[model samples]
Structures are given as structure tokens and as C-alpha cells.
Target: MTTALLAIDVGGSTSRATLVDHAGNCLGQGRNRGGNPGSNPPDLANAAIVAAVEAAIADAALPGLTIELALLAMAGPKFKAVQDQLETALKALGLTGPVVFTGDLQAMVASVTAATNGYCIVCGTGAGAVRLRDNELDAVIDAAGWLLGDAGSGYWLGHQAARAVTADLEGRGEKTALTSAILGDMGIELNDDRLPDGRPVPYRHFVDTIYAMRPIELARFAPMVIANRTDPVAARLLAQAEDYLVQDFSMVFDRELAGPVVLGGGIVAHLSGLQSRISEIMRGAGQVPDIRLVQDGSVGAVVLALRSAKVTVDEAMVQSVITSIAAHGLRARA
Candidate 1:
């Protein structure tokens, strides 16, 4: 009967569970739809969580394998209820270990960097920044959600693109590729405003309709801006996002800012053009920290759980787990 460690990364779009042994060896992995309550309804979030965990347990296929410890990286409100629901799900999967829940940002930072003192910038469906000392949160910035801040986030870009497109249609803003891209993505005709009766719909009608969509749905428009990075409006918005993130990092660090800077989420992790741009900007600003991308966030849960279990894990062990995960791909299915 092998004892296993369970690591779960709960995100706005999906949840993944990874099972590993004491030697940092991958056992099984499973994935399902988004489970974070901040980005999903409670029922949907819980269901996704259960489905993913069940899949991982099934993949492990070890009847006597017991989860020694588990770490859940999650974001949402009404946490007590969420915890209860998560606990029930874990029990159903026969994982009775004590589970530790942490903010997704904290888990992300821990996953990539080896330093205890550093910062994390997440550019996902919603964006935010966090500072960590000794692997715990020290400060937070712009995680105020889409309605308030998250200045350089995907939601921000998508919402701003919609606003700009509408303004352009109303003769209030400069033209940009976003106009056609957004309309195309939404399946709205360029002449959607003009009825067969010849009366044009108000620009507000377009804006309102788009607003009626879900947050993650609207975030779909963000990549269009990135796709048109050379367009003036898109370039300017990207610069704004970059500047906003840099400024947020500046606020969290000292005048002599130098430490591990872990970059996670879609924008930095996937967009090489933007990643190079951001790196160039930071280099020019003379605030270069040790930057690294998360190979697999589930590895963070494993590392953290191992540490909590009083296992002495060095940087080599951490890097090995990351390497193994990447080699196996994100969902180490077998």
C-alpha cells in the first residue's frame, strides 16, 4: 500500500488533480472543467472538483493507496462552505488526509520559483499580483476582481475592447482590429444594428448584449487583441497592461527590487511575444528578478504537501517533479 500525495489546482476554466509518491514520482493525473467559485457557480465548481479528483483516483487504480496529504489551490468566497464541500468530495474519493487550502496565486508562485521571498503576477481570466515571504502571502494588489481593478487582466482587455469598439461605432474612438474581431467572435453581423425595417440599433444595444455574457465568455475576446498586437489600439492596450503590471510589482517591492519573480497564468506563460516585451521592459527599467514560468502548478501542491508532511525537499527534488510533469504533459494521464 503506497501512500500518495494529492495536489489540486483549481482555476477559472478547469481543475486538475495529480497523484505522486514519496520519491516525487508521478502516479496519475486527471482534469475537468473550471472549479474555482470566483469564476463558476458553487454547484458547478464543486462538481468539476469532484469529477477531476475522481478521475485522478481512478487513474491511480491502487485500491490500497492512501492520500497522506493534500493541498488545494483555490479562489472563491464563502470559503467555509467551499471547504466543507471539498472535504466531502475528498472523502468520497477515499482521500481522508488533512487538506490545506490556499489562494491560487500563492500556489502559483510556489510552483515555479525556488525562493521564499519574491512576487507573483497572474494574468488569467482575471489578473492580480501578490508578494510572498517564506512561501506565504505578504502583500496583494489588484485582485479586486473584474468589476473594480485587475487592471492588466484578460477581463480588463476584453471589456476594454468591447467599450472601444462600441465607441468607434459611435464615432467616439479610433478604429481598431478589435471591431471586426469582436463582432466576428460573437457571431454578430457588422450590420447587426440595422434591422430589415432600416432602423439601426443603438450602440448601447451592442454593449448591453455583450455585457449579458459571462466573465469567462467575455475573456475570450482578449486574445484577439493579442493577435492584432501590431495594431495601434491593441499595442497601446498591451502597453497599458504591461505598465500596469510593472507598476503593481514596483509597489510591492523595494527601491532595490531584486528577488525571484514567478510569472504564471495565460498571458505570461503562453504569449512569447508579450513575454519578451514584458521582459524587455523590465530589463530596461532595471528591476529584473529571477523570472521563471510554472511547468505545472500541480507540482506546487505536491511540493507544498511534501513540506507539510515534514519531508526535507531541496531545489533538486522540486525541479525534478516539475521536469517529470512537463515531460508527461500537464495531465499525466497514466
Candidate 2:
């Protein structure tokens, strides 16, 4: 019977599971909601992880195969606390071998390069930077949380967008296109009531709507902010985001590290404008950055899983896994 490897990437926004064999063939993949224990309730995160793993097992349809090992690359700081629960759930699903958990940053860096020393920058619902020495995390910056740091993150952008609109509505800030755009996006209309400042606004409606949601949910406006970059307010927000992200990368950057600098997560990977700006900044600093993008941590999990099994994973093996994942339609956001 062919042995299988289970690899999972759990993030602040989504969780993914991929089942692959030693030959680098992706047998099946599954996805579920965010499963970050630090950012989400432990029960909810555990549930999401189990759901994704179960779905992947179901998708494989090869019940006879034994899962030899499982590796989960997890976002958030508190995943270790739930490791026992996760292992129990995986065993119930037929994971036969030992389970390993590691920081998501390792997977992010491994997804793009096998080199031992490198830098990683993640910008999704949150933002952070890390330096990897010998394939282990050596330094970190930001990644605090929506309420704390996470500067240049998706939540940060959305929060800035909301603040800009609120300021404009109250007549305390410069007027910009974000006011109408945000209101329309939220399906909020201008109310007849005027604020004490005499500006016609939907203060009550907007405030009530925003207050009703968890602060992290503000990340929903990130894409809108990115989309409305033509607006002066949005443009300024993006500029600030870019600056913050660049700052994160710079803080952990080592001029002597010879390995590639890997960037993951939705914001930095998908936003060409931000990517270009960051590249420009790095170049201006007289550093020739070997930047690479891994859309999510899934591929990195696969690489780590293979390595853990003593499989000699070269670039050829990694590329084969990448191709198989794409063929199986498991590539997350490409």
C-alpha cells in the first residue's frame, strides 16, 4: 500500500489540507475557514482544522492507503496549546504517524526556497516579518494583532479606510472619494440627520454597523481599499500600508543573508502595486533582493512534510509537487 503524507496550512483567513504521496502526486485537497488559535476561539479553530482534514481524506477516496505522517504549518502563536486536540482528531481520521507543528513562517519560506537562511514577510489579515537561520525562525517583527500592531496588514488597511470615511463624514478631515465608496459598499445611504458639525452623514448607521462586527472582520474592506486606490484617501492609505510593510521587511533584513527573501499571504503576494513599491524601496537601499512569492503556506507544508519523512526533496521534487497541486486544482489563489 502506498503511504501518504498529510500537510496542512492554517491561517487567519483559511485552512487548507493536501494529501500527497512520496512520488509528489497530490491525491486530494480540502479547504475550510480560518483556524488560527491565537486569532480565533480555540474550539472554532480546532473545528476548522478537523473539517479541512476530513474533507481532504474524503476527497482522496483511497481508504486503503495509510497516512504516514502529518505536518501542520500554523499561523498565530497559540497553536501549540491545541496540538493534543488536533492530534487526537487527526488520529480519528486515520493519521497513523507522528504529527508535527511549526510556525507558519517556516512554511512560507520553504514554499518558495529550500535554502536554510532567508527572510519572510507575511501580509494577510495580519502583517509580520521574520528572519530564518538554518530553516528556523531567528527574529520577528510586528504580527501583533488587529488591535495591537499588525501594521500594513489587511485589517490595518480596512481600519484606515473606515477612519478616513468617518473623518470625512464628521467634517474633521479632508473630503475624499472614500466616504461615498465606503458607504455604498456597506449599503449605507446618507441619512437626513446632520451631525453637530452640520455635515449630512450616516453617523448612526455607519457606527452601528461597524460596532456590530468583530474588529478583525474589518479586513473585508482591504480589497475595497486596494480597488479604490485611485482615490486620494485610498491612495494615501495604500502608501502608508506599503511603507509599513517595507519597514517590517527592512527591520529583519540581513544584508549578509544569501538566500532568497520569501513573501507570502494575500496582500503582499497578490498586490502588484505593493510588490513593485517594495521592490523599488529595497533597490533604492542598494540591496538586490531576491524576492519570491508563495501565495499561501500550503506548498511549504508539503515541502516540510516530505523533508520530515527523510525524502530527498530537491527543486525537481518541489516543482513536481507544485505541478501536481495545480493539476489537482488545489492551488490556493495561485
What TM-score would each prediction reach against the true structure? 0.86, 0.89
Per-model C-alpha lDDT, please?
0.75, 0.82
lDDT of 2 by residue, 1-334 (tens): 6579999998877899999998768988899998888777789889999999888888888958778999988765765568889888888888899998877888888887778888888888888889999878888998877767989889888888888878887778878787777888889996578867766669667888999976777888888887788888888887787778788877887666656778888887545565676566567667675888885478889999999888887777777877888878834445
* Most accurate candidate by lDDT: 2
Distance (Å) between predicted and true CA of 309, model 2?
2.2
Candidate 2, superposed: residue stretches over 4 Å from native: 79-81, 194-201, 269-287, 330-334
What count of clashes does model 1 give? 2
- Quote the positional error of residue 282 for candidate 1 in Å: 8.3
Candidate 2 accuracy as TM-score: 0.89
Question: By how many angstroms RMSD does model 1 differ from the true structure?
Answer: 3.3
The 10-residue segment of model 2 with minimum total lDDT is 269-278
